[model samples]
Target: MTSKVYANAVAALFDLRDGISLMSGGFGLCGIPENSIQEIRRQGIKNIHAISNNIGNSGRGLAWLLKQKQISAATCSYVGGNPDLEEQMLAGEVQVTLVPQGTFSERIRAAGMGIRGFYTPAGYGTLVAEGKEERVFDVPCILELPLGADFAIIKAERGDRFGNLWFKETARNFSPLMAMAARVTIVEVEQLVELGEIEPENVHVPGVFVQRIYQGVDYENAIEIPMYAEQ
Candidate 1:
C-alpha cells in the first residue's frame, strides 16, 4: 500500500455523520488532541457522541467542540467545568452517561484486548446497573460491556512517521487504550520524528492501531490551567 497522507492533519478526523461515536483521549485538559478537536469544530460535524474521561474545561480540549454544539452525547466520568454542558443536559439537548473512573478505563481496555466483554463491580445496584445483564462470579460484579468507537482522536508526546507513539506521564491514561478501540485512530503529536527515532520498547501504541498520524504545530501551552498559575 502507498504511504498515508500527511498534510493538514486535521483532515484525517472529519467523519461528518450525525451519529458517529468518537473516543477522545484526555483528562482535565491534559493529553488532549487539541488540533484534531479544533479541526472537528471547524468542520462543524454534528451529533457526535464522545467517550472520554472528562468533557475538558471550557475553551480547551473537547470543550472546544462541545462549545460548538457539535457533541450530541457524552459518555464521561466528569464534566464539572462546562456550564453549557450542564444546561444542555438539563434541557435534554445532550445525553450524558456517567461512568466510574475505573470502569471507564476498563471498558476501553477490554475493547482493545478484543475480549468481547468482562464483569466488574463498579455499578451493582445504581442507575448504571439498570437494563444491563447481571451475573455473580467469584465476586459481586456487573457485566461490563465493551467500548469502541467510529473514530478515536489521541494526543501523543511524540510519534514516529511510522505511527509508533509515546505519551508523557498521566497523559498516557486513555490514549493508548482508545487507539486500539476505534475503527480509525488519528494521532496528533507535539513532536514528530522519522521512524527509528523512538525506541521500540517505549512506544505506547503500535502503528497497527494508528491509521493516521501527523505533526501538530503551535499547541497553546496554557490550556485551561488555574489562573493562579503562571502561563
Candidate 2:
C-alpha cells in the first residue's frame, strides 16, 4: 500500500506556491490545521486567497497569515474576532468576499459535488445582489457559484497511513467538504494509526480525497470567545 504520510507540515505542503487559492477547514480555531498554517508562514509564501468559515481569532490560527501579509484575499462568512483581518479589509489591503454563512457552506459543497451553481434566497435584495444574476422561483433567489481551492488544509482527530480521517465534535464542520472541493487535500492529525485501524463506518473523509497526511505538533486550542464557568 502507498503511504500518504509526510515528515512534517512543510514537506506535506511542498507543492505550495505564492498566489494560490486555499481552502482552510475550520470554524474559527476549532478544527484548523495549525501546523500547515505555520508552515505557510515560515515559508513566507504570499498573495494567497484563503477560503474559510472565519479568518481566525486574535493573533492565532489564520490570523497569523493576515498578520504576515501573506493573504491577499479572503472568502469567508465571519471576521469579528480577527482584528488584523478586519483592519486589512477596512484599509483595502485585502479583498474580502463575505458570503452568508449557510450560502458559503453550500457554495463549497457545490464544488465538491461538481455542480456549477445553485440558487439561494440568502442575499436576495441586499448589497449582495448588486452585480450578480438574480431570478425568482417561489421567492427571489441569487445564483451562487461553487468555491474550489488549489489545496485544502484540514485537521482530524485520527487518521490512518493511507489517509482516511476521523474528526472530533464540531471540528468536523468544514473539513470533509473542503477535502472533496480542493485539487489537493492535506490533513494534519493528532494520531496516526495503522491502516484499517479506523472502522469503515467512522471514516469522515475517505483517503481518495486526501493527498498527504501528517501528524501535527504544538497544538493550542485557543478559545475565540472565553466564558469561564461562572467564576
Candidate 3:
C-alpha cells in the first residue's frame, strides 16, 4: 500500500487555496490541528468557508485564521467564548451560521453517510427554522442538508502511514466525522506509528477516509478554561 505520510503540514496542504470550504476538527481549543492552522496562516489563504464547533476559543485554534481575516464565512454550533469570531460577525466581516450543537454534528455525519438531507426537531419554530423546509411528523421538524467540505484538517493522538487514526478522549470530537465528510482529509498526529501498530478494534477512523498524514510538532494544547479547587 502507498504511504499517506507527508513531511509536514505545508506538504500535506500543497493543493489548498483561497475560497475553499474547509472543515477543521476540534472542540474548542482541544484536539485542533495546530500545525495546519499555522501553515494556512503563513500561506495567506483567504476567503475560506470554515466549519467547526467553536471555531476555537480564547484566541487559539481557528481563531488565528479569524484574526487574519482568512475566513469569510463559518458554520458552527457555538461562538460564545470566541471573541474573534464574535467581533467579525458583529462587524460584518464574517458570515456566521449558528446551528444547534446536535444538529451541527448530525449534518456533518449525514454528509459522510451520503444522506442528502434529514429532518430534525432541534431547530423548529424559531430563527433556525425560518425559510427552511418544515414538516410535521408527531412534531415539527426542519430539513437540514448535508454539510461537506473541500478539505478537512484534523488531529489524532496516534496515526499510521496509511492514515488509520486514534484520538485521545474528548479530543476525538469531530475529527472522524470531518474526515469522512471531506473530499480530502489531512491529519496531523503526535505519534506516527507503523502499520498495524494500532489495534484493529481501536481505530477510530479508518485510513480510507484520510488522504494525508503527518507527525506534528510544537503543540500548544491550550486549556480553554483552567480550573483549580481552592488553590
Worst 10 residues of 1 by lDDT: 1-10
Cα lDDT, model 1, residue 67: 78
Whole-model alpha-carbon lDDT for candidate 3? 0.94
Candidate 3: segments with Cα more than 4 A from true spot: none
Go through the candidates in order and give the C-alpha RMSD of each one to the true structure.
2.4, 1.3, 1.1
TM-score ranking from best to worst?
Answer: 3, 2, 1
Model 1, residue 229: what's the lDDT? 58
Order the candidate numbers by lDDT, best to worst. Answer: 3, 2, 1
Model 3: colliding residue pairs:
none
lDDT of 2 by residue, 1-231 (tens): 667899889889998999999999998899899999999999989999999988777788889999989999999989887899999999999999999989888988899999999999998899887788999999999999999999999999999988899999999999999999999999999998988889999998889888899999889877778788975
Q: Residue 154 CA error for candidate 1 (Å)? A: 0.7
Model 2 spans with C-alpha error above 4 angstroms: none
Candidate 3, poorest ten consecutive residues by summed lDDT: 1-10
Tell me the TM-score of each prediction against the true structure.
0.92, 0.96, 0.97
Displacement of residue 11 (Cα, Å) in model 2 is 1.1
Best prediction by lDDT: 3
Q: Give the true-structure RMSD of model 1.
A: 2.4
